[model samples]
Target: MLPPPIPSQPNVAIPTSWPPSAYTYPPLLGNIQTPSVHPSGSAGTSFGYSQAHQQYAVQRQFWATKAYQSSVADTITLCFKILREVPGKPKGILVRNLTEGEPNVLASITPPGLRQLGIQRMETKLTAALRGLRVDWTRIPLREIVIWVDLAHQPPDIAYFHARCMTGKEPQPAPSFKKQTKAFELAFVIDSEYWEEIEQQLADDEVRSCSFSKISNRSSNGRRSSQHTLDGSTVDLESHARRPSPDQEDDFELDRASFNRNEDHSPVCAFSADLTRALKVSVTAPRTPPPSKRRIIYQSPNQDHLRDALLEGGSSYSQLWGQGPNSTSEQIQFFAINDCSLNDLLADRRFQGFVCDPANACMGSLVIEAGNYLGIGTFKTAEMGYLTLLHLTAGHLGPRANEPVAVKRMYKRRKTPTDANPGKWVLNRLTSADEHSKILMEANVLFWATSIMNFTYSFIYHFIQSSSERPPFEISEIRFVRAGVAIVHNQSTGPTTLKCSISRTYLIEERINEAKDGFYKFINNGSAVPLTMTRKDASELSEFLAFTQHVQFYKTKGAVYLSDLQGSMQLLTDPQIMTSPLIGEGAEIFGDGNVPSAFNSFPEQHCCKHICRWFELPELAASTDSDTRSVISNS
Candidate 1:
């Protein structure tokens, strides 16, 4: 005999005075089957056993009463089932290990419960409760059923049911990257006439189950040949829906002959009453293309080539990316991709190329990962570790797009307070505002250098603070421009310094008429000199004057060579020239390109050397020995 029912607990009352059609929970009752009792136990049970049976019978009777039906007992039972089965919580499958004091459904809902059931948050609690009764979906509306199944962690079939109910339309399945990808190998497999027969059988029979038999292909000679069994039933070869022969329909043939209906050359007007049904069937059997085929293309970086391509001067790009002398910890922080498994995604070439194109040119999704730092001048040395324009577009590295971009990772260096060496470098984290300030400061410096000082280089695209905790990266949009050489033939200024103090605008004004006249003279008689402002000419001149002024100011302020501007200038000079190539004029190396004597009298190298000189201003050294050593080494 089965164990007797448990005793009834005090029930929570549910409201029920709403409209008749209002959503209501179906009444839950204990199984109504007649209880079986063991004959031997009934004849020889002890007093305690007898009392237990009486109590059990009373409890079962109590549940059967109207009072039990009026309470939240059924909802509570459903809630218990969901709490037991759902995943990813203390009570769910994902987190099997629960805290010592976590409450179960029964404990949570009881009056003496440690935690309240949280009825005020009805959506979460009530939705979960309804979803717990998954097998009994008929109690809920179609829409509610869909949402409940989704939230309950039910299988995808629930979604399919909702889709079918909404519209007798099948949804196209998305392409899966996994191995088993085919949906159906054969198209139009089912015969429409056979399906109608099954429907008729279902409507007519009391059979608890129905199954397919076999479908045979019709041969060209109007005979059934290849046979396939579905269940045990044989599919008929001839369809009853087809038009009957004229011999079979004698009256129709007679009417056609009598009225000359057969050959009036008029079209027959036939109405299809089941057109909607046919359309529904056609729409419900949607065909989706098979999964995409992918070919793997691996790109392995050359460590030596990459390492050799580090940024110039004291700043090392590799340090930021753990490719240089400094370890990763020496830099700020890392920006990790959120939500998705970036490693797995990146490993798949198709996903990387199509989905995660850093340039975001593809039609698919795009994700940008950049580090963020908190302050201005984070990178005191030369910026490094940023992606190059070539690398970004080169199919061997990033996406195959013509878009050009240069990534620059900047950082600031500061001396630790407790360190003995006052000028020693140390890495530190900054606040978000500090990072914003740093970017703004760089923008300001570049703006002034570009607009007021007439400096020129690749322009910045935009600033992005990807992560506040990590050092930020910058992008430079590359625009190709042809460079012409301009010779500065001034004898008064040094190769790294400028002869003129005025800006490029005034220089242009002073030489404009002369340049026009010279050009006309040269074109006509091949006699005059050329006067043109090549790339970086203005920037070089400006930097030269700026550096000179900086040196003068710092020299008066008691700055020494080793510890001040002079030492800095030495490191920057080489890189600046390489980048700009206009700072130092070599008349013999680059032939004097017929520049006007008047304009050439005040030209700087028009290369990056002037920028280096500006960045690296020399201070007065302690003695001739130190100064001579520095000068000799720099030269």
Candidate 2:
């Protein structure tokens, strides 16, 4: 039975010796009211404290660097290994953790000092270890490995070991005392035949050229003979059992679920009830929705499960973007929420001044302000969202100080909420997601499973519908997702994603300029659609081009280059541009030698039907000349 509540005591007057002084009323200004200022002369509410904001600024800088991220990825990848694949499950792999050091079976098998080696060197050793092992590569799926840290069971401290023994059953009392003593001595026994072979090899006159034999070999059958003693074989006794039959697999799944149901999850869960209570206690704290949808209630995942999921996903950063192998379903939703908050902040009127000071406009400030506006108190999830944004934004930037440059952040909704685009009450029309771009997938861009296929369809569709007198439609709007691109008569389409190798807007602008200077001048003045590119289009194009050039330069990949444009343009104006030193510089510096192959393949594709027909049009002399000129120049 629970104890009863205690009765309240009567109030009594206390002495005047208490530290807190009695409250006093402010001095009233009867007829002349004026604002009061502090003697220190510091102006209205200041958030300029450098030390408090330094961590966020530093984190942004660190994340911006490629070296830091690469190192972290390498370290995480090195922490685990694939044990084996479980049968009856296509995606399942039994993994063993190696981060906990030697007592972990995988750890004991690996050579010492591997961690001390550089990533490349370490990879070389790991590859050598697996070479010619005859293991089924398909069954052993390893994108990432979990690293468990358990302080209760410490790994062995010894540097070297000869053998390890493992069994499928738990230990019990020995049948006799003689059996116990016999087991101890047998465990330490060394095989004489294995040593003899090694000694003979060392004594050989042609040590470098001698053909080597296996230290030990097993027969085709699964069983071993008496001659094949413990020292004669490398048996992985600690390894998990092989794939189970279909019936066994079902039982295994049921066992796991029941075990979870019976388990006391509160203590093992990542966030306890106490934490949830504390989070709810803060009136101004941001509300973290449960790792589920259709409900406002909060729920925390078990700590062990969460850790295991992270390790399996390859990198924590990758997991935040929902790119990991084991990323949770709610991770994407959580990210979408943050993206909404970020979009709101960037689209806000106050962001203009903040972005101007790049030093103070790091993600931390974005998170802090976004949290305050959204009423989100969980900074950890906010931090993950910021990191995820930074990750996706790598090698990408905005044209202006503050803009939604990341393609993932650009989308349209109604200005005021109705049945359409529900939950998004307020919308910014000035953003990339204008009314026309809301249903991008339904537009001219026909998506396919592959980039080459999508481009082929787009090329043909444009070529067929395009007027011989007007400029050819520039291929725009490449989606990294389905690798789609739109081909239209005009440039009314919204921001093209960064996934495209070249800026379609820039190409369209260049084409328009070419049209104006050449015989296709009619398209400039009398055309139904405007030939010129708009400011918004130019800004988006510039950002895409900038990032593409950066990636191309760093990797020396001939995907796209700034020099390709100049070369193509100059060739039309001056045929000698092909022979000029500028052209030579383009070939050498920007790797233009690769461009011819790309151009050659475009005409051979089935998409060339309309363009081929357009080329045959001779009724309009100037139009034909311009089309031929553009084709020849591009080729």
Q: How well does each candidate superpose onto the true structure, as a TM-score?
A: 0.16, 0.16
lDDT of 1 by residue, 471-581 (tens): 122111111111101111223354566434211000000011222322111010011112232434332333443343233223222111110111011111100000001
Error of 2 at 210 (Å): 30
RMSD of each: 33.8, 38.8
Query: Candidate 2, which segments miss by more than 4 Å at Cα?
Result: 1-129, 133-177, 181-427, 430-450, 453-635
- How many pairs of residues collide in each model? 33, 4
How do the residues 16-91 of candidate 2 rate in per-residue lDDT, one tens digit apiece? 2434435432322122222233333545322221122224445555667855563421011123332333333343
By summed lDDT, the worst window of 10 consecutive residues in model 2 runs over 503-512
Report the error of model 1 at residue 565, Å.
16
